[model samples]
Target: MAKIAYILLCHKDPEAIIQQAEQLTAAGDFMSIHFDASAKSESFAMIRDALEDNPNVTFAHKRIKCGWGEWSLVQATLYAIEAAIADFPRATHFYMLSGDCMAVKTAEYAHQFLDDNETDFIESFDFFESDWIKIGMKEERLIYRHFFNERTHKSLFYWAIELQKRLGFKRRIPGDVQVQIGSQWWCLRRRTIESILDFIRSRKDVIRFFRTTWIPDETFFQTLVRHLVPENEIDTRTLTFLMFTDYGMPVTFHNDHYDLLLSQDFLFARKISPDAKTLKARLGKLYSSRGIDFQISNEGRSLYKFLATQGRAGRRFGMRFWETESSLGRERELMIVVCKKWHVAKRLTDQIRQETEIPAIDFIFDEDNTALPDLGGIQSSLAKRARHRRSLMRMLFEYFESDRLIVCMDPSNLDLMHDFFSDRSMTRLLRIECDFTDDYLIGHARRIGLAGDRTSQLTLERLLPTIRNDINHEADRIRDAGFSRHFRIRQSDSTETNATKLVEFLSLPYETALKLAQTRQLFDD
Candidate 1:
């Protein structure tokens, strides 16, 4: 039989967390703890001091700023589990318990139960099952990003998280990883725990995907365990007894519920608060149990207390990918011009100032620009490439407050264009059009031709139709999606006035529009 490693993730109820630590230490089991980084500093220190005598215990070096239902909560749990693996080399079974959880069964019996059975204990189920889901629910969590709301301070994101779920912005869960949801508490074998850690450390796509998701804790581990661990080797039952209540906190157990805890055949029971004195007073006298002179507060599953918990831990994960220099803030009407590369959309913005009083912000996504990183090879360094796009997404979030966003794509970079508008609300978009063969090559050649030297470029015969076909396909897709503002601009000798065409395309509401007196002729200086 292998030694057991007890991993505890503690945020509140310092005394209870430490008491649980001491009991496991006394049981000759290795114990590890990770305190929430955002918790009151002194309380965390006090808990450490109280548990100073326990040699079997180890604390995680780094603390995570954990939030309820967000990915950070899951991050803290991962850190603790990783720390436990480093602390105990010989331990084979790993048990995860909350700060309020107490071992009701004898240490000998509990160890025997784990040692005798080859089963891995975990509680999980398909989240999309009808009973768990409401009728006519929108896309499942995997498809859409669930987010937290600011005003009401609840996870009101049946919509997108601060990071949109649409392509280019959000990370996708691996196709191999199935959807699983269950009780947040569970136990895993050493290998199972290691497999999960591997997933966390190397799985950038999954981590970045859940970073903005709501209550990712429920699915993060459940999906990993179910996908990696074989069904025969795992036990689907939860080892602890839980009581859900209307309030955020679980119902405390008194002497009256002692039999009920034992009757459930559960090894652990929750909630040893000061109010549960009758039940805890007796359990405190047992060997390996230490004195609890300090009273620690327990902030339980607060989402239940809607208004109360909303005020606490309301901050979701901040945008992580990119940084910005613009000063655009709330309550201002701003326009965004996201071009394919440096000044690719310059012509589009020429008459914009003549048309609108509101200022416009420009963000260029072209990889050639100094602002963005290179879009490197597919396999060499995926982490860097993923971060590259993530930086772009962060840039998108910055300009998200725009009243109307105009995404301008060029023939050279149509692949990167679709992602710009996918995650954004269609209502916020004023127009999405591609400009092909818009004097880019000829104009640039003209500027450099003044220096009396120029490099050879592709012939118009080879470039024109290819760009035309690509822009046509892109335009068709956006129009089919019901965006009436989608159009294409390809200027030629017989083509209509470029400026006048744009003026009508945008449908700008300006008092005095700047109309070009005479459209320039092609190849004119």
Candidate 2:
């Protein structure tokens, strides 16, 4: 058997780690976990007990201080890898992942896929031009000055500005520099692991540089891998998961539906008024209405009764009865759209509402809103149409005070709309577009029956969206955003000396060329 070790560095939410570990172990994969030593003793004990039953799980002790950036994370990761490699020397590859990461496919499937590709799936993008790295530097400088120099946690922004003046530096890193960046989660060949460790041992300057950097975790491995391996040996573009977030939190269905569920008395065993008889009677009727013929416990019956009331109230108010919640927190707002045929929209809307936590308002163009209208005085020319559309978008955006907005569209229609909203400024108008095309890949996964539990539905509805102007575009948007450099048509791939032609054909902006070259992984992916 080819051994693959799963390495996780966890600080909080050990349950999530255990959940992920269970999936890996069931797939016949080896596992090693390193938890922050500074966590509460009870939390550690709970994690220890949970993993004790799993023979594959090995826990390591590591002291990690919060706010240490990637330095602490890398330390923990390296320690786990060393231990895993020591015990499983014959292991074919080591997969590094976070506790929060959930596998969309089984480990066996992933292993086979990797075996077929025969490539290391580490994101090897040049990090120097990445917005995250530049932002990290600015954030670190500000935090250091406020907490260390001023001896107070407040005024970090002011102190950062002062320090910048004294040091004669700016927050932005020049795009030409070859810095590396990627997800900490990666699958590495044994040789690659050893090479990285050996290079780190010899590069004292690199270690010193990271000690003071804000997000050392994201950069250290990227820089080390870039230095140790031939670029071609590394598959910089491929990612097993495409993570999207608003307001620095993971978006999930749980967070979005809780509020709407509660408002209608459909959650918490229908215990809203504490009248057991009323709850049971209501729940019994609700079950019958849904064609479900299962007996509920007294508690379960009450809960269902309350949920039915909540569902009725949500419908009366024209609100989404289900939603996926974002992990960002309660302060954010969210909107979700799913592209299906006209009849499918209603079912899709219900499914989306049940699965996500954000408040979703279904807008079926055929049922709720009119199709695109020809704007008066607007010419059909691209420039004229784009300007007019922008004007209309600006007016609509100003009406909402949300920090995030998502526009979900059908895949077939994406190309038609790309020309109207290809500008970077659209990012400021709409932050994310959840294209249903991407969801097709997961259709083969096990299907859970439709849930009508008011409590379940209520939890789904209360979730909100944070981080205004978050955009989720399909592959077309990515292509329009100049990702063409990362890939070439099969025919063009064999052609030599076509760099000029490629650039001209793609119509890439000259200003972004250097940045594109440095961070090619974004396009390559």
TM-score of each: 0.51, 0.45
Question: Tens digit of lDDT per residue, candidate 1, span 361-472?
Answer: 3344333232221122221243443334433333333323234434333434334444333433332333334344545544543543522134335554454465456547
Candidate 2 vs. true structure, TM-score = 0.45
Clashes of each: 1, 56
**RMSD for each model, in Å, please?**
19.4, 26.2
**Top lDDT: which candidate number?**
1
Q: Tell me model 2's lDDT, rounded to 2 decimals.
A: 0.45
Tens digits of per-residue lDDT, candidate 2, 1-525, equal 456777777776676566657656765577778887767877878888998888777765455543444356677888888777776666778877665444433344455556766656666665534564322244443223222211111135446656867897644432333457776667778888888788768766656556545555666677677777777778774343332221122222122222322233111111121122333333323311322222322232234335445634433222212121102223332232323322233333333334332222333122324222222223224444334444433222322323333333343344324433443332311212223332221221112222223434343333212111122334345446542223322212222322333233223343332232232222121
Model 2 has a clash total of: 56
Off-target runs (Cα >4 Å) in candidate 1 are: 130-140, 146-152, 155-172, 245-249, 285-525
In model 1, the worst 10-residue window by lDDT is 317-326
